[model samples]
Target: MTAMTPTHGGPWTEEEFLALGEDNERTELFDGDLHMTASPTPWHQHVTTELLVALRAPVRARDLRIHAAVNLRLTPARIVIPDLTITTAIDFEQRIVPGSCARLVCEVTSPSNAATDLVLKMHYYAEAGIPWYLIVEHKAMTLRLLQLQRGTYVEHLTAEPGGVLRMSEPVTAEIRPESLLPEH
Candidate 1:
């Protein structure tokens, strides 16, 4: 059984947060506190799986590794687990991947952590100098590509169900937003 550590209060150190995560898969350090989330709903997993399938070809073509939810060390104070991450390294380090090693980080948003994916992670990734960040919305079926420019992420592409996102910055491919939706 996993040891449960409470982190509701503010002001947490990196080591303390990691100790909590040693037994908790959902523990993410954000805003200097541990943010724990409930297990994702079926719909959230569906969207994440679909996106991974759609990205397979492009990911393999570039000789990059595609990983499911994994620890991403965005900063000393911020350690997040993005839904999907593409990295240039073949031998990816287990548990924590340095932000400098990631080619692109993608997060499929669930209601439980949409703000963390869209807003909080954006700032963290930008600060880490990560080149690209992708946000895939669960219900709306939108794929937003944010490219880091100067010192921040500038919106590159935002595609809805009918639209297609032709990515060219961090990676290159044509992605249809509608295909990401799980069929009823």
Candidate 2:
């Protein structure tokens, strides 16, 4: 499906949002509004790739699927494209994955969208009852894991530069914050 030119005059319906299709631009629907962000930087892409590699073994062993940059429908009116997602629901035929199916959603922060990833998306993911949220901070070079507790996200782990983030739940993986950065 080709991406459609979005009309910005009014609130967007799910049908209208879905019809916009997929493209390089990151487009999301929040409360009948359309938000479009620029493409991620090379560093952002590198970190996502490294994290995907690190998580693949455990995810595959558990028979879960890990996808990068795909449409995730949090609600009928709330659709987002998460940086990475680990899920049990594997319906390749569907255009978007239901948020209910996600075991964990990850976001890698960029200077342009730090607030959105750290605050906005975190709240939405928690509100949707997603169990785990992971954030990879670009400038800080740290990895943080947040677990849903009482309908809010609380810090579960934070791995600084030389430190390792070891998690057995969601998926068994050990990641070093420095390992995710691209070589300069």
Give a tens-digit lDDT track for model 2, residues 84-178. 99999578899889898999999999888899899889999999999999999988988999999999999999899999999887988899999
> Per-residue CA lDDT of candidate 1, range 74-142, in tens?
877888888888887844546677777888899888776677778877788888888888998877888
- Which candidate wins on lDDT? 2
Per-model TM against the reference: 0.85, 0.95
Off by over 4 Å in 1: 1-11, 21-25
Provide the clashing-pair count of each candidate structure. Answer: 0, 0
TM-score of 1: 0.85
**Model 2 / residue 57 / CA error / Å:** 0.7
